[model samples]
Target: MDRDLFRTVKQGTRNQARLLYHRLVCRLPHLLAVTLLLVVAPRLVSTLSLAALWSEARANAAVLLAACAGCAAAAYAYAMSRPRPVYLVDLAGYKPGPAHEATRAQAIRQFGLAGGFDDESMSFQKRMMERSGLGEATHFPASLMSIPVDMCLQTARDESEAVVFGVVDELLAKTGVRAEDIGVVIANSSLYSPTPSFVSLIVNRYRLRHDVVSHNLSGMGCSAGIIAIDLAKHLLQVHPDTYALVVSTENITLNAYLGNNRPMLVTNTLFRVGGAAVLLSNRRQERARAKYQLIHTVRTHRGASDRSYGCVTQEEDDAGHVGVSLSKELMSVAGEALRTNITTLGPLVLPLSEQLRFLATVVLKRVFRADVKPHIPDFTLALDHFCIHAGGRGVLDELERSLKLSAWHMEPSRMTLYRFGNTSSSSLWYELAYCEAKGRIKKGDRVWQIAFGSGFKCNSAVWKALRAVDAVAVGDTGSPWAQDVDVLPVHVPKVVPIDDDEASYKTAAA
Candidate 1:
């Protein structure tokens, strides 16, 4: 993002304007729903009158009026809340050293010989390590690169429950959040379906107050992180002055695909060990204490019936063999999903100029059918920084073009991919941390995070920094990873763009 863009947003109550716009946007859907009701209500009422149903007609009117009033009140309350993310903490734990890379290549080669090779390579692994400053671990194979069965909950049913609880314990220590104060708990694990479930394990482990609202989400892919954030946002509104903990991670052992399909290979090569716990609250008192504030969230899902939903999928063959696969058309599906998500999300956060441009194009294309072209989303207007989904270099390239994002706007996300490999759901947080390390974040700066998942889902969370980090957080072992990130490859370093098809690698001993 350009400094001028940030300056412009701050110049004349633009933040205030953006907030009002979002409040209205939130009500637009409900308003449209009610409008449909209005169109249908009169005719239906008259039809019922023929049956002498006067009381039912009056009751329907009352219900409609009440709903409209409630929506208005909710919108007003949200607009007045004025909550912003305090600071974003991106985790860089489980940094992949060199050994991980060799392991992956070995796995691919061995699997390929048995027709189990989806051609999952160490290319992404190498890029992730170099970007993250993780020297040798990038070469480690899936066997070593992946989390232990115990960690991803691959053991007995009880064991899986125990693993998630153990992680929650670590989370409590990291955030210093007590069990009693937590008003909401959201856990997203797409693979393993343990008995008591992921959320239940966390609540039980912490012995959280019995009244705490808990939600467990499964089946959603990497985008589950932001979906979890949205869920927390709503819970905050329902119970103000309460804490909500959002936990996101994939069960590596469960989702791991051992097959020869190319799409499945992408997953084996990209995903690695990672998990994150975020603390969110709408309470004014918690503002100064919170790490990151909830500015805004947008979720767009192409249903299971949509083409994009099958773009990235796992299925069993007619013979009953199970495996994950990525279609050659996955990128196109992702682009379409992004188009829908941005169309809905951009208007709420972007500036007047960008919105007008977008709107004008829509009008020209749809109404006049003029010889005008559609405009790519102007993300620069809405955010000072961006954590583009690090699904892959190809995915990033497509988004950069689609959103018209500058290279700097993509740096943190790219660097995050380099260091963390795709840590699945937690990758966005790590990318945000990279931006903070680069000294790009300032007080009141807006950060946009976009993540794509298996359902061909696009989920986005917009955050405004309330304060800058005074110093790097204690848990960020990747700090050393960021020390000389500008030049990159601080040790025996060699760097290249991930999209460079011609780039070659020379093996080095760790």
Candidate 2:
């Protein structure tokens, strides 16, 4: 036993010595290089004559001069080739009057009294309302409030005229931009398109120049605002030193679904009246006065796929009543669109370090076949503010969790939902307005405005603020939240379950 112990100890010592010898051998070149750099390098430098170094520099003068010239030329060429920046000079979100304000209780009582919805449909609407995160202050068009709702082109026109004129007047007033000076007008609405396009409506109302670039985009739902911004950006890029007006509105007075289709009825409970107008310019003179400079606009359209195209659509029910159907596949389709949009946008906006981390994760998951959860790139690192479209409470909830955003980051969207309900394409602007109203927008802050639309499209609009926006939380600043923004940043409960019993619902809504 003593001999065995002695042999084991002798073997362990031999193994340690052998390992140490190998380590020293492996490090020999590095040690020698370090010694030369620390000791021999200084002595060599001391021994070197100034005349020799001067001769070397003189010999390489032509090459050094040529390299510097080449670098300057390259920089000049890059500067000239850089894309012109698009500036958002000012923007306005329509604030409906007190007559338009519709509480959730009002919706319940009015819809119930209207007798349009059967008991089952009414019950579904109540449930949706309970979870919708809407406060008692959302608006509905006056046309919608009429006892027997007037569904006519005239009524729709009235609604559109109100939204379009309201926002445009405010925007024009704030910017002090003249009608004829407007070089381009791009208007977007999902459901209501008149014979004279919305662009024409703006043009005729403002008496814009005959040569003005005009377009009316239709059937592009809630994401249309970003899409309109994208369109305006392109137009501004081409039409140098010009102002472009982009109007986004959806006339919900025409959006009421009288049908009992459960899927279609969701619209009745969620959709509300709202609109926005934005002024964009590519003029160099406008930079100092601009609120934000457009950095990037990315749009992902999944309409080619049948499932995505049909996810949210207007169709006649079995009984021949027309309504918009919010399919079960809608969220999944939106998710797919959002995934594609963010992936494309990630490379543009994410910092180099973040991009590298995301790339490494992709490599690990795809190339290495490692067992790992899919990496959700931390967007908060790249963006200072997020104006996620407040389409509904569910959408906000899903994005908050998926994006790993804090409550502060989501406050704008949530408060918008609570205060304004779902304003469709203009909802994103309402959210942005909330931030502006709160004086949260600071100079150099990068804001990411993301929205999902009915063409099954996901879109992103990125901006960098020029200066801090003042807290315009009162009067008519064209912000829907301006009137009540001070009382906001309210604590919205995770779930406010309402009673299912019919009698209890009346009291709950009240």
Candidate 3:
């Protein structure tokens, strides 16, 4: 054997031995490290006069090991705990009342507002007026009754198409995401359909690629916003990297019931015109610019029975008069829908405290036979912001009470209803904008959005804000409604009525 080769082999063996020793020591217990150091250190130190050096080294090694353990635990904890960013983005809205006024006036007359109907008609009108909170039924002159159902119907059709296009245009302009880039388009209109469905109108208008997917929801009611969001989530999950466009609106023109049917007449008193288009994408690049990320989506349908399903429906009487009627069973049916939604959503976003409270209530009510049961899960624990469906003042009030939310928490929804009436599915976005405009939302804040509609369905979506929206940047094109809002919490004292001013002014001018 060569002398050089033997030296090289010896050096390689020593290197391998050191590597094996290090690997073994790295896995040793904290106490074991101290034990090993104590057992070995005295031999390495070997002070001539110290016979008990090993014991002293062991005591010092234990303290050093404990310090090292604390640092190691902290490093491990920090590496495992890091925050993820959440984003929420709002798209554009389209206005509804662009139809000619003359057509609207004719619709009012043909619909029986100008003293055309008899006793049965008058009776039904009275009932509807009472239900809608429009005070007692009174005849309005032909000129006074203005909202033409026919013109509204026409506008509903054209406006829905316009809303869809406007959304597409906004997405392209704001995100620089072209129509071809949008993989799915989900457009929802509660009523009225033109020759080319609103979805097709958008695709054709933009000359989108032939393969783009499209869905049109004809009569899902206001809850269609979450329905679309859920659909978009599923599409995004399946299509790797994709963008989905969700547009929500209600077609009020054809939806108006002119007959003396009280249920249908309730719609005439409210329901303003509005539409919203939102663009959602699953791509990482797009998510950076996105305002809100879709956190969780839950949907529940109470269509298990005919009664449950037909709570809100169009009916025709024996006299051949058509109208939409509501069953006394509708409120219970809505509650069922809401119950189903909470069941599905509660486990997803609720905090541990809320979950425990909910579980305790269910257990106490069912198992223990307790005299008192706890309330349902604390929804406020799960969400800092809420954009509940603004279907009506009554609907908003019901949700606020059920959820134990504050008046300020429901202000956005109430204001949305006052401003836009009921824009059907698009109403949620309007409500969200109201919250943003008031500077109520903060970055990383969670928002709970819930909507209910005709399917006896309740749908919900949870969103977390990624950034604080600038107060001045927030826009409400219909801020005229805010003029009616009392800015302070306290209500002003009522003033005495005066009748002479209007008549006197007119008389003096004459």
> RMSD in angstroms, all models?
12.2, 12.5, 17.2
- Checking candidate 3 for backbone clashes, the offending pairs are 87-291, 87-292, 87-293, 88-291, 88-292, 89-291, 89-292, 104-148, 152-253, 153-253
Runs of candidate 3 with Cα error greater than 4 angstroms are: 1-88, 96-156, 166-171, 473-510
What do the candidate models score in CA lDDT, each in turn?
0.63, 0.83, 0.63
Q: After superposition, how far is residue 33 of candidate 3 from its true place, in Å?
A: 26
Better of 2 and 3 by TM-score: 2
Among all windows of 10 consecutive residues in model 2, the one with the lowest summed lDDT is 1-10
lDDT for 367 in candidate 1 is: 70
- Model 2 Cα lDDT, one tens digit per residue, 278-346: 999988999999999999898889889999989999998887878899999887787778767776677
Q: Sort by lDDT, best first.
A: 2, 1, 3
Which digits, one per residue and each the tens of the lDDT, describe model 1 over residues 1-510? 234223322332454467678778877867888999999999887776655676765669988788889989977976766443333322223333344344333433333333332223444443443343222233222433333323234433433443345455555676666779988889887765677787887877778898999999988888888998888787776786677887776555555555444445566656655666676766676667544566778787776646776777778644454656778888877876776676667657777787667557656766787777666656776688888777776788778787777777877766666555676777787677677666667888888899998877889988878777554544454353443345542232335334322122222110
Error of 2 at 457 (Å): 0.7
TM-score versus the correct structure, for each prediction: 0.69, 0.82, 0.70
Top model number, lDDT: 2
- Candidate 3 per-residue lDDT, tens place, 1-510, comes to 134323433443454466557657655555576898999888767753465665766769978788889979976875444222222345765543324222222322334533334555544433433333121111122222353323444555554555566555665676677778878888887666566778888888888789888888777877988888887777666665677878777655455555555555656655545678887777766656677887877788878879888998766755665656667777667776786677666756766677556556555755676766446567876688888887665677678777889877776676665445567788788777666656677888888888988867899999877777644231334322232234422221222122223323233223
Best by TM-score: 2
